[model samples]
Target: MPATVFSCRWFALCALLLLGGCQPDQPAPPLDQQLYIWQRQWRPAHEQALSASRADFSTLRVLALQAQPKAGWSRARVDLAQLKADGRPVIAVIRLDGQLPALDLDRARAQISQLLADWRAGGVMPTGVEIDHDSGSARLSGYTDFLIKLRGLLPPSLKLSITALPAWLDSPQLPALLQAVDSSVLQVHAVSNPRLGLFNPGQPRDWAERWGRVSDKAFYLALPAYGIAVLPDDGGAPVVESEVALNRGGERRELLADPQQLATLARQLRAKPPAHLAGLIWFRLPLPGDRRAWSLSTLSAVARGEALASQWQVQLSARDGLYDIRLDNLGNLDRPLPARVELNAEQCDGVDGLSGYTLRQTPKQLIFTRQSSARIAAGGQRALGWARCTRIDQGAWNVYP
Candidate 1:
């Protein structure tokens, strides 16, 4: 070959290599492995749990702690060092107050920039930044403009994403908003009152199909890994509250998706996801001792389409001739266990702990029957009603499914 031809070939090859090097790393091809870390504190237990479940997760979206806006934005506490050491792609999340003044965009931007700078100075580099805002449709234009400006300010190498509302999915500015970010997380779980249900399989499926038809940008469907408590108002209206209140009092119902239900949903989405639907991002990364939320094992089991096992334990106490039996569900999945409880005690007359349940004296035992709409929650317990017995001992009790 001529010297000029050989030189041209070498130059082309060098150019190709340079281009390839300059290209941003294509994100790990949308995996079934992503979780959101909303907790402000990163405990050793959290680290251990993450380490154990590390193989199941490819990305960790950590929330950048922020307090109520007074005059300017203030950084909240975050485990930046731990997050960096986790050895996974991290997405720093800035949860903007939904009620933030629209006029304070510039100030907010400056505060966010400072946060980014601090993250960099601290040696914590995130592959992306996610803006979590619940702005309404009317605020779409402002939100979109803010995102545009944010994109301009963000480093070109880093991607930008947002947690999108289902309401905004139908807005005309949605496409423009999506265009401003490299990817978005469409949360399809909390469409209705969580009190009604944590998630309805059909709602997410329908929304995913609809969203898939609309935009072609990369996205993930945020699913619930947590449970919520729904208390009835004086007027019988369902009011959703945090799980903490469930222990306080009142007739509140705890809502959570069954593991089987979640597994089925996962299978459905995996089999037929939207063109842009990347994968599922669980609402939370479960830590050890997080009773209100599904554990890492449960999440893994659901992802693998496996059934969750139920463990039940009963504790008996006696006071004032009344035997109190507490039935606790020590399982991961919220499921109905055998409500018919049989006690090996004679002359057991009346019972009082659970409402809508009846105790009948059989020839050999006392059988407690559960009424309709009665179910046990995982890691939760219900009183089996006090039984009027002559003596309370470690009597053999059997719970029938």
Candidate 2:
């Protein structure tokens, strides 16, 4: 070979090697879809929920039990019998209260051992056990110690994981904590105050990237798929209400995680998935009647990366000299309630909008203006208002012009 040609081929090989080294060692593969069934108690709705969601969600991370501060352990009402029948693997999770000042290690292990034995007797073997503790950054050392000890009881066949918080990224011990578990779930949501909102589109990607750089273990992002209502307590701090209800009477503020924003984030993650990133696990599965959560149709659409859209339809019913107004969502995506609705009416003695809408009476028409950003779920209907009118065509209403 000629000396110049040999030199050129050597330089070309070096350039190719350097370029390959600069990029990710491997291309980001398709993300696996999973869900966190965080409901403290199981209900009949779960049967249908599991069946409907089984097609999209490949695995479930269930809240098997909780370790409360003074309340000790509150075992979840999850039907173990149905887990195997559902035909998806499950990861049993034990949530320890972040408020708890101390870790009761022995009791937790005893409870877990019994829980596992019970599950086995019930003919269900979970894929792994995940520890979900919202410990502060300062406690990462102690938390890692606990996880290391907990690792002993888990068999080699089962993989151990933890529900990690974004705040832990600042802790140096985070790597050790990751080493103690087979994997971790990075939760990107925090409903601190309604004013701040449930999710910020840009921040979670930052967390995923930071975590990927810090840990070698495989991890998944826990995204929000639900909303919460907040009310002020006697103190100034906000009290968040999720699946459970509060008995106190006070004005409430609601914060919802936008479906569109979540869908956009999902696509972005798929485009450039973080290192060791396995998939996404949506927080708390949604039931058909879950007023605070997105509908299954919306979730499925978001999971599959279908286009986000919604079509509103005005449904009017008249009987007994009264007309009722309802809006139906014809599209698969959940949509923000229309801000304005106008309908021509011949004789509307009185009209009023319901819930998030307010009625405005014009000389010849009735108008409804939305008061909030509440969204109507896909394939669902909401009664906007009613009017006692002499005559109005059912198809005369216009949602927005």
Candidate 3:
């Protein structure tokens, strides 16, 4: 070959190598979908949700399914066969109580070993094990020690993961602790203050950015799919209630979230994810009849980047001298439907079946509005109230936004 031609080829090769070396390595594709089953009892709704078209979860993180600390060792009850039949990889989660930090290392190791043995015996071996602990910053050292010991006990084939708190990232020991595990799940949701709202809009972005800069370990972000009630305390300050309270004949109040917020968060994460971020893990898998949670269709739509729209319908019916006003939500998103139905007082004498709703008498129309939380689920309907009419005129009834 000519000297000039040979020299040019060599230069081109070197340029290619330098460019490849300078370019950042692409991160591995994240887990497309994941969910945590915190409830012990497996309701039919759970099965239905799992089978639903929208629930295309690739992994199921089952909590407290097989193991719990008892006596000196751990007690386990895992149904490996059933889990295997679920047609997805299972990540068995073992919840540690406050007693974890106080337990003897040797005893803790033995209990964990026993738990694994129980799982193996039941043929329900997990693809990975996740330690769910909300260890405080002060307990970082202890938590790190526990993880290191746990890693030593875990089989080389099984991945060891943990549910990490944002607070842990602030600790200097975080990087070292992360090194001890194969992967970690950063719970970006539930960090919101009840006094503020069920969720903080900026939390996901803030945590992801912080985690990207500090940690080099692979991790997933856990987001919320459920609602929380913010009740007023004795001092009138807002406090988070344990759960949404409901009764057959009692007042009810709730603070429900719009799932679109989660979609917005997902978009932000996808647009700017941390270098080590793996994917998202929903705080829970919502099931049918879970009025307080997003429906499967809504979640799927959000995941697909589809906009959620509202659809409402109202109907009036009468039998004898009594009349009924019903409101329905036909949209994919759950919304607070119109709680008040207006009717001409000349046609309707009085209203009933609205125990928790208040009635207002205007000059021409009667307005019945809900006094508490009155949200309707997608495709769900509820009676606004019934009216006693001097003459039932269904055409005169109307619903307000």
| Range of the 10 consecutive residues with the lowest summed lDDT in candidate 2 | 190-199
Report the C-alpha lDDT of model 1 over 95-143, residue by residue, as the tens digit: 7777766635666567777877888787787888888888888899988
In terms of lDDT, model 2 sits at 0.87
lDDT of 2 by residue, 202-267 (tens): 899999999999988899999998988888777777678888788878887888888899999999
lDDT of each: 0.74, 0.87, 0.70
TM-score of each: 0.71, 0.86, 0.77
State which candidate, 1 or 3, has the greater TM-score: 3
Residue 281 in model 3: lDDT = 83
For lDDT, candidate 1 versus 3, the one ahead is 1
Alpha carbon deviation, residue 229, candidate 3 (Å): 3.2
User: Candidate 3 — what's its lDDT?
Assistant: 0.70
By lDDT, the best candidate is 2
**Pairs with backbone N, CA or C atoms under 3 Å apart (clashes), candidate 3:** 80-124
